[model samples]
Target: MAAGLLLLVCAGAVLYSAQAQDPYDGLPDDYKKGVDLAMEKLTLDPGVRHHFRFLKTLDKSDIESGFGVKYIYHHFYLKPTRCAKGSTVSNAQTCPFRNDRPLIDCAVCYKTAADQIESFPKPYVHCIQKPRLTEDTRTTRTEHCKKMNYNSGAPTLLAVSMPKN
Candidate 1:
């Protein structure tokens, strides 16, 4: 058995298989299996898509299996929706946030790092991220400001009355 293993190793073929997923393409079979199992167990949301990359291993080779150990970063990107005017602040003159151009693509997807994950990362917002100096849309957080009562009493049909015996 040892002689056969030696022959296999001499062929320069690591523990990778042809049928492994694209993210685990170069990873060893055992590591791919583990990652696959782990990913299957993830509580992924409905719009989440499978996105993974092979990371470096703590050990270059598994001590038990003599195969290359692999690390992976796997997470799904949240699909961004079109910007809408949701802010209800009364003092704001113009709408906050980038309502001009929507995010065409995820910036993280084009980055060079293979093992980086962009799970639930906030997209570049114009008002928050690249706000103009003159735009007064950003809310100034105030600790001492009087709370504006939004609940100005809901509309009612009948007046309040005392309980009758």
Candidate 2:
């Protein structure tokens, strides 16, 4: 009877340990769904969005990728829009839009992932808008954001991308 009880205890302990060990357990399902939705939206603009995949367990990989993409998008697409009205707006900076400000900033939209992906760093996706310059006038540019990386991690682990549009 003692031996059977010991075996049962050992099995319970092993089960507990297995349940406690979470490789991608840090990421929540809701957050993962949000990321999926955002990625789907971005994929619609595949010509202008780049997706970079990375390992899920690493920290800051997704954030870094998101920031990098935000940097490129702001510089090429959003900045130009701000400058169109002869505003002396600085590039590669935070949002200039206030509650009363009429300007729409991409940083406001793209920065969401930076904070959300603090735990899992897998499937880090970023979009770079490649704008074509026309006649030295910078008008009539074709903006294309391409996926830089895709599914770049081990098959055993789940990689969650950032959810920001």
Q: Compare the candidates by TM-score and give the number of the best one.
A: 2
Please provide TM-scores, in order, for all candidate models, with all chains considered together: 0.21, 0.22
Q: Which 10 residues in a row give candidate 2 its minimum summed lDDT?
A: 101-110
What's model 2's overall lDDT? 0.31
Per-residue C-alpha lDDT of model 1 across residues 1-165, encoded as one tens digit per residue: 999989988665544543232333466544444443333332143332322222223222222111221122222211122222222223211223233432211111111113332122221111111223222332321111112211222232123443557
lDDT scores for all predictions?
A: 0.28, 0.31
Off by over 4 Å in 1: 1-23, 43-61, 65-165
* RMSD score of candidate 2 (Å): 20.9
Model 2, position 112: C-alpha lDDT score: 31
Clashing residue pair totals per candidate (backbone < 3 A): 0, 12
Model 1 clash pairs are none
